[model samples]
Target: MALTGSLDAAAQAKAAKAEAYKAPRTAFGQPDLSGYWTNNTMTPMTRRPGVSSLVYTEDEVKKMEAEAEAEVEEGNAPTDPNAGAEAAKPAASSLRPEFAAAGGDVGGYNRGWLDPGHTVMRVRGEPRSSLITTPNGQIPPRKKGAPPPPGFGRGLGSFDSYETRSLGERCIIGFGRNGGPPMFPNGFYNNNYQFIQTPDHFVIEVEMNHDLRIVRLNAKHRTDDVRPYFGDSIGWWEGDTLVVETTHIPQSQGFMGSWKDLKVTERFTRVGPQRVHYAFTIDDPTVWDAPWGGEYEFAPLNGRIFEYACHEGNYALPGILAGARAEEQAAAEAAAAKAAEAAKSKAKDKKAGD
Candidate 1:
């Protein structure tokens, strides 16, 4: 009787522990969300053409990945001297439209440094066709009469003071939406981040430009009517997930051409030992007819985040890349001139024979 009672007591204790289980916690006793993470995957933000479904079969994903790899390898390979202009034409079908774009010598020869993700993005082992979860795997169409978002220097900024320049041009922030409420990869490089959690605040140190997103925990929204760069973010813990609602995004930094009334709700949850599932819902009644959102999984960054002190060096690289573009333009012009000369010669010969 004593032995049986002891075994029963042990079993009861195990059951109690299971019922009260909790996720890993920080030293301050909050669910730990502090670490370096990355969301680099081959999945585009919106579904690309030819992708028929939200979730792709393993075989389909493999074929697409293989094709992308092969195309890169071919692009980087040495060109054949005897090959004609036809060699310049893109393949009839491609992994996506961007892959077919002629990125000049810089993108072709310098691809080793680019980390645009090699494998498909998987959520719970299912390879997703895109990060967006809409039925069509795209952003919902804008409302019928939604006004276009205002741009500071889309075209006209030459004569004006330097103040009129775009945020990116001024180095206020880098492009490609790396430091976003719905933080996304730059798609070219530097897709890493360091997340820090404190009792009163949550800070995200973006690798690109060292952009910092400071979230006030359990705080009320500011009503100064002044728009901020990444917007005013306030977060609270809902169980183990950090739920954040952001508003007042600057017009230049709005997501999908929304700003005045844009609101983004983000949820970051620890899903496993090495992964954190990030999801977001975007709401702007004037922009879209309904609230829409997307999701992607984040894994621990392989390396640490280094300080990115950017300033003058940014222009040096763009200038070098521009040289590559100029080279391609000159070649195209020469080819066109040669074709025209050949046509004229043929015409003159025929006229003389007649």
Candidate 2:
């Protein structure tokens, strides 16, 4: 790409500019955004079905949050020591669909280990009904006959090969759009990040998948048609706000399956001592008629960033493939054994007739 350069140049530039950072502000007098922050909340990227507004009333917020808080309490209550295995099964109906997986499946977290924040996402003073600020508070419709979003979920596709699995399953990147051009909450845990800004680059160290995103400052988009994770991000300072433009997003990582020609513009501004107002807009004429995205606030993460170590001690993928093969072989053996039994019975009947 005419724009893409080796990470070496970027790294060297950042190393040189590292000296320019004076706490939160660079020597250039730009607002500093170096800190550990989180965008974890109950709010989802798209609007909920049948919801008509962007902002929720205080009463509505209280009721929804109370429900979430109660669910946690119920989950945290001590279980009967002699409870049956069935008790470990995750009941999707027991919690909101958005949070049903908090319990995961059998042998997963219950409540105390879970970290889907209870509070619905609030932008400024108002509770947000949805993140997308579009007129309908939803992703705009695709052009007629536009292709469906590609890729299959763990259960929906063949798992014969590791490549067949989802990116999250392979531990290639954080699942649920965690390492995003327009980053979004994973709807699960590990939604934390550290922002390290140098005069030449802005780096977001994602706690999930240990994804490291480097944003080149005042750089040009690559014309090489290369699509990599986190895309190609170039940023500039607009007053105290850092405006970033990302393109060439990989199709598998596309937002709602709209990646080609996608350009995501994100603005990160330190709005308060404890919050950073993160806003984004997506534009892809091939997919939608107009651009649409949403805004959310990043609160300070109480803890430090830790290694995700997705592949280490993760036997789920190996187990999935091995288990599938074992099941297939068992089924084939049973079928052959049944055929042999039927042949033997037929031979005995023939002998009697003879």
Candidate 3:
């Protein structure tokens, strides 16, 4: 939130400092953190050991930035925020770990479909490799052989239908990983986000499905209500930072490996005119051994967030099902023709022998 709308720079600075020093409050004196923001970046959810820590060497930052810029310049950008299954670069496999699994040579979109920026964020003007601060810069692995999250219909009976797929495939949530607890950029272009702040809460609308995450500040967790698709979140202010802790995630909204017991802690701090510092910690003891966290700087954009309108426009599901039916019909017809031909050949042979 704007600092009291005072025009004086010195006064604003003083107020901001004071606000950061104290527990943050909302516009209604409750710990104000209501605004539009986004978290679409090349930064991974976890850190990479080669690029561990928020601090990056000048050479590494320059190299990484140059590569990303080259990608854009060469007209090889990403597609929609959650638009996976795209054609990756020729060297996609080599770049896999450095990039996410989304980096592939498989068929998909090009640079014309991407919106990821080239320049990495500077916390204090120094580039960071990942949002996470762990030594390895990676999320800890899930417990060995931990069962897949519930609601997964993988290997289900034939009659189970495709409803067992992820919320994204069903066009329920944002198409990509645009929404957050640890919001990371997808391979697509519209991974952009918008933030709306009100007197009591903050709403983050991801551009994909227009997935909305509402964080209620200075409030208690909703323990009695049904678990939400995006989990339950309660927010508070720690000085200038807006902190939100989320839990009670439904099985439908699994985060990578962890299932129902996952917890995410997020921090949003407006550190610059066009930028906010976004940090998050993920913990699920049943899934991981230790909590891991990361931070990324979000720069404000000029465009307005648009409605995703996925359900209305979706045609992929019907198309896939129809294609399958057509294939089955063709196969059955071919089998029947083959059987008839075989019987006719046998009758002809018998008549000739007689």
Candidate 4:
């Protein structure tokens, strides 16, 4: 009887603690969201094949972490310069077979430069396989035979002009959706973000390419013709959550081919002292048959954001144009030489006949 009474008292105490918890507020009486945060995780946007569940069992999580540690060890292994060419081939199980070839020479950077988080994403004390919460754990399929919307710099055909390259390659926006209306982790380094909130505005400063997203508070979106890179975002406080609605996204800066009439709704709520719950929904009738959404949590980081400085040292543009010019000149010379040879053969044949 005494043990039962003790258990009841403990349960009541836990309930009381939960009731006493409250979110911290800003000086202006808004939920404080001003801090440096990181959304880096090993959790993929879609569930891996053969994984039947969204949440992993404790044993499954342990095995996953162990595999990750082994991968990290293999990646950090010292490369032997004297190794033979035959020894450099990629294993069949490698995630990126192209990078594994030639001792990673073809790939831009070594494994040391990559920092796609080591562990799976933990939300509400459970390790999740994917951030996407749909029944299939994947982004909704696009409409049948739906072509990608036309926009500037959409394809890479010729390097005759700078506009042919992607916006991210041109250093105009963050690459791989690092700076987004529905921001996601880049799966590489520089996955940090800094949030600054004011009475009239909220800013999300992305670490990659140093992209900044300025969201107006309690305001309407800009005119439709004035599309921005990350879209025109307007926010309002709903209880402890900051609700953001974004529209007028530039077609060139569309996410997953959902640009035309795309609408993104995001909610940010401080669920714990060090954690912020983030959820976003993608709505575009022209692209997907139905709206799809994902949820994830952001954890506070210790350091401040630093400048990315990408364009200042970029030399690829001039190099690409120069290579194209050389190829064009060579093709023209070959054609001219072939025509001259044909004319000379005709003259020689006429002289022989006379």
Candidate 5:
């Protein structure tokens, strides 16, 4: 009886402390993370299976942070993947997770270039396995071996070349996991985001491709004909949380060959003065099994999202095609030369036999 009393008192006290730390609200009493916010934590795209669903103990979070710092330190010192076999063990394959499966073998950026951080922010104190809450943090397998997002095909001429390329290689959108059908975070820099709020609307601006998602608060849903880049989004205030449902995503802006039918529902709540808890649920029957969801705590960035001028007609496209054509041409000429040499040898052998 005495032990139970003590436990109840401790629980009440913890709850009281949490309530005290909760940020004071706006004039309308909405928690405000309206400033520039970024989540730079290095939590991987998929959760490690053995990890617990609950937040990490303080000691564990610290250990993970320390490991991340060590990785950064090692990356600062350049090491070659082609170094002696023993030295090369440090450079393991980057293509382990399903995250890399969609991106078939585009190579040569070092681990040093990646800013994926080590410890995720403990929002309300839970250390996350991934932002994903679903069993096995993944986007579910692609159906029927849908060919991975199309790569730049070899071009026959000028017009046929640039128009048919990948969005990222042409410098139009962020590559791989950057400019998402559902806007996934990536290894590259500029993972920052900013939220601007008015009474009637909320705008989320992701730094990749300068993708801006506009949510009409307390507004009517779009009709079926109204397709959009990031899809048409509508928001409503559900208690203190802002729930935004998005649909009608254009095929051009999707991942895993599923933009047309993709549906993303996101919730934003100002949990702390500096941190906005961002959670999203992705639902595309064509792409995922059930509605897989994830959450990440956004840390405050000091400034606004800078310009991301991802232009289309860059020299990179031309360069890539030119490089491919040159290799093909060289191979063709070599084959012809080898055939001619074989014919001459055959003629000499026939004459000697005669």
Candidate 6:
């Protein structure tokens, strides 16, 4: 009886300690959210095939992780130049070596450059297969007859001008939505971020392409005409949670065909000393049948952020244009040659008939 009473007292004390825990505050008495954080995880933006549920069992998670590790190993393996064509054929599940190569050229980067996390993202102690939390664990389908989003769905032949290139290829925004109002993991390298807080504003600096997002605290969003990359974000504190709303996303930078009328609301709260809980809801009546949302946890990183200089000394843009011109020149030459051959054959046939 005495031992049971002691155990109960200890449990009560522990509960009290947890109840008293509060996030550190800034000089102006706001919850301090300044830190280096990473959203890196193996969790995909949408549920993968064969994953039926949003949450995975422990055994399922282990199996998925093992498969990912095996893929990493294969990616890191050295290729033999002397190998025959039969040996070069990639597995049906894997990308062709040429496709995987940087710029679709020879001598691509090794897998060491990849830092896709080893494990699925954990939310509330459950391993999640996808970041999206819709009943289907995917983004809602586009409204019927809605026009496809700009920049995509035009097929691969639209590279006639620099403006037709993707935002990432142009170095205007981080690839894979790394800098977003509903920021998500890239499933590749440069998945870190730094959060800097001030009395009246908050800033989130993404590691990929060195993109930055600034949120004005307790302020209204900018006018509708002033669209910005990652949209115009305004934030306010609701108890311990920092609530942010973003709007005015440009049409060219739309998210999954939803940017024109999209509004993203995000909530951030420090749930533990080393973890922050992040949740976001996406609403775009112009695109989706209904709204959707997701939840994930951001863990503190020990290292400092580094700069990603995407455009310095870059020759890819000019090279692409030059390649296009070369193709056009070759096509025109071939047509002229064919026409000349036909004309010569017709003149010879006429002389023979005479």
* Candidate 5 clash pair list: 42-117, 55-127, 131-294, 131-295
List the pairs of residues colliding in candidate 4.
none
Query: After best superposition, candidate 3 residue 95: deviation in angstroms?
Result: 9.0
Pairs in clash, predicted candidate 6:
none
| Predicted candidate 2 versus true structure: per-residue lDDT over 1-354, tens digit per residue | 011112345445543443343335667677988889988888887778887777776788899899888878877877877877677554566566765654646676676776777898866555787777777776778888776665436334576788877888788888887789788887778899999977799999998999999999999999998898989999998877899999989877887778888899999987666778889988988888887788888999998998787578878888889998999999999999999999999999999999
Candidate 1 local accuracy as lDDT? 0.75
Model 3 earns a TM-score of 0.72
257-331 in candidate 3: lDDT tens per residue?
575778999888776555677777788888777777766677666677766664677676666666767888999
In order, the Cα lDDT scores of the candidates are: 0.75, 0.79, 0.65, 0.77, 0.64, 0.77
Q: Candidate 2 regions off by >4 Å?
A: 1-24, 87-94, 101-105, 150-156, 327-354
Pairs that collide, model 1: none
* Native-structure RMSD, model 3: 8.2
| Ten-residue region with minimum lDDT total, candidate 4 | 1-10
User: For model 1, how does the per-residue alpha-carbon lDDT over 149-259 read when each residue is reduced to its tens digit?
Assistant: 455345243423445555666677776678897888756667788999989999998888888999999999999999888999999999888999999898778776788
TM-scores, in order shown? 0.74, 0.82, 0.72, 0.85, 0.70, 0.81
Top model number, lDDT: 2
Instruction: Write one digit per residue (lDDT tens) for candidate 4, span 1-354.
Output: 001012235445643553355778889988898999999877887778887677777788898788767766776778677877446433435433322432355445566666777788866555777888777687777798766645434546667787877787787887766778788886766888999999999999999888899999999877657887788899999988899999999877787777768999999888778778888898988888888888888988778887788678667887888889999999999999999999999999999999
Give lDDT: candidate 1, residue 228.
Answer: 80
Error of 6 at 223 (Å): 2.6
- On the 0 to 100 scale, the lDDT of residue 158 in model 6 is 57
lDDT of 5: 0.64
What residue runs in model 5 are displaced by over 4 Å at the alpha carbon?
A: 1-31, 49-57, 78-113, 140-160, 176-181, 255-257, 285-289, 302-304, 309-314, 325-354
Sort order, lDDT high to low: 2, 6, 4, 1, 3, 5
- Cα lDDT tens digits for candidate 5, 1-354: 001012235445643554465555556656554778777666765667787443455687788788767766755676575776445333334332432323223343444656565566554556665656555555466666454654333223444466666555565556545434355567556788877788778888878777677888888778766776667888887766788888887766665566767787888776656667777777877665566667777788767788887554557666777887898899999999999999999999999999
Residue-level error in angstroms, candidate 2, position 88: 5.4
